[model samples]
Target: MDLDAYVAAHAFEWQRLEALTKKRRLTGAEADELVERYQQVATHLSVVRTSAPDPSLVAHLSSLLSRARNRAAGGRTGTWRGVQLFFTDRFPAALYRLRWWWITTLVVNVVVTGVMIWWLLDHPLVEQSLLSPAEVDQLVNHDFEDYYSEYAASHFAAQVWVNNAWVAALCLALGILGFPIVYLLFTNMANVAILGSIMIRHDHGAHFWGLLLPHGLLELTAVFVAAGVGLKLFWSWVEPGELTRSQSIAREGRTAGTVALGLVAVLFVSGVIEAFVTPSGLPTWARVGIGILAEAVFFAYVFVLGRQAFHRGQTGDVDASLLEDRVATQA
Candidate 1:
């Protein structure tokens, strides 16, 4: 397709459009020229995309066209509609689209935790090396339960929210590096497995399950979601398929950002349950039931709303009209 020759033929028009777009003010003639140059470059972009499809050139043209369009339209600001669309469409679609990643993460972690607990239980020496008899007794009888009730419920909820949010944020932020997410998730599950093994060994299995299930179900699920999204970000660049690494990473990064924002609310709900429901005077059945219900509702939201948004062609990236068109087909 002689991509170089086509780019050379149209470079001047693109440069002229860029210059006009950056101008502080435009006379009527210059304004008309800006619009003319915009249209010409837009055509050049279309032809280049159809005939040559060079990644770098297409990205450059797309950026230039976006700026020109915005400059021509006088730019726009954020609005309530955008926020509403993010929750109702973008966020859910992202979760739904990436459901398998997180669901698989959840399953794998669960199995790992189960195996870890079983192994720990089989080796009393392992528990003894980690914690002395007094420490184990303190944890099994009082410390574990006391940890939840030591602080006021509201204060504890806030603390839990912040801590979990930070972990989730770390997953999304360090996801590009890949191994950090694995390390973080492993350490997390190891802690749970350690505590469960210790308590169950001391004939406190009922007490442990009662306290953990009410909040752990939804809380851990949120963590799994974050880890899953983070790994997906890592995979985007690793196996970008037809996309250039930058394009794939950029698209997934935006979707990851949406998931990060949505997880804040999810963690808050789990935090509230951890502080209030987990430590409340309610019986084991009710507390566990509340936790189960929250987890069920969360999955329903993802599968129902997210699936609808995905089917409607929402990929959780920012509006397509404002970005480069990467494919001929919608979504």
Candidate 2:
């Protein structure tokens, strides 16, 4: 076919192929095959039945094809598409994978929480040291009823959500330093333990669960996910696997960072629920149900949508020099 006709005939298929490739992982052989096919198609298009093509024909074709493929692969159109790509495609795909981290963190947190609870139960003075006199007095007098009411009245849901979202973002960002993630996880666990101890001491543990589970589940999960992504980065540095430390770090950074942004979104939504819906005196069963439902939705997004969205492409240009260097260096 002539260059123009070939371009016109194959453009749509190429775009679809590009999107599919971006959204799904492919083996090295498959990637090589696809790249070869793409080059052949473009070469044929460049040579036949045309007056000399534009000098920048390959570059122009690649750019146009990339944009079309991006749009086809869930990218938005227009100026804001760049922003959306940053957040949705780039950010979320990098950072969010919490199951391993959550499991590890839950064990640590639970152990720490148990120790703290035991200490507080054994030495009441620990409570005095942790809780102010006024706070203790209020707890003893069952004045938490009024305190909670006042606390609930004062904080607007929107502000709480924004604040929590900011915290999650900060955790992910700071975690690049490595140690900050451990600190953040430890601090969060302390908070949960402290709160649990106070409630258990006051014989209001059930109420506390009702109030917290509604939002705490999702909020805590997000936090753990962020920490996990950070740990992944740290491990890449320490272990390096088959990749050089730098390459591994970069790859981990991209995937873990994107997933972290998604966690921030989860935290934002959870915070809103915690501030508003969770504290509204719902029944224990109702709170648990909501928490379970939210968790289900979060997992669905992470596993199903995440896999579909961030998988590596089957076709793309490979740097010949880089491959040659790796082969030579390894040999």
Say which candidate scores most in lDDT.
1
Q: lDDT tens digits, residues 96-157, model 1?
A: 99999999999999999999999999999999899999999999989999999999999999
What's the TM-score of each model vs. the native? 0.78, 0.63
How far off is residue 317 in model 1, in Å? Answer: 1.4
Residue 111 alpha-carbon offset, candidate 2, angstroms: 3.3
Candidate 2 local lDDT, 102-172, one digit each (tens): 55765666678678777767777777888897887576456544433456533755566676666666665
Which 10 successive residues of model 2 have the least lDDT summed? 322-331
Question: How much is 321 displaced in model 1, in angstroms?
Answer: 3.2
The TM-score between candidate 1 and the true structure equals: 0.78
Number of backbone-clashing residue pairs for each candidate, in the order shown: 0, 16
Q: Cα RMSDs of all predictions?
A: 6.8, 9.6
- What is the alpha-carbon lDDT of model 1 when measured against the actual structure? 0.89
RMSD of 1: 6.8
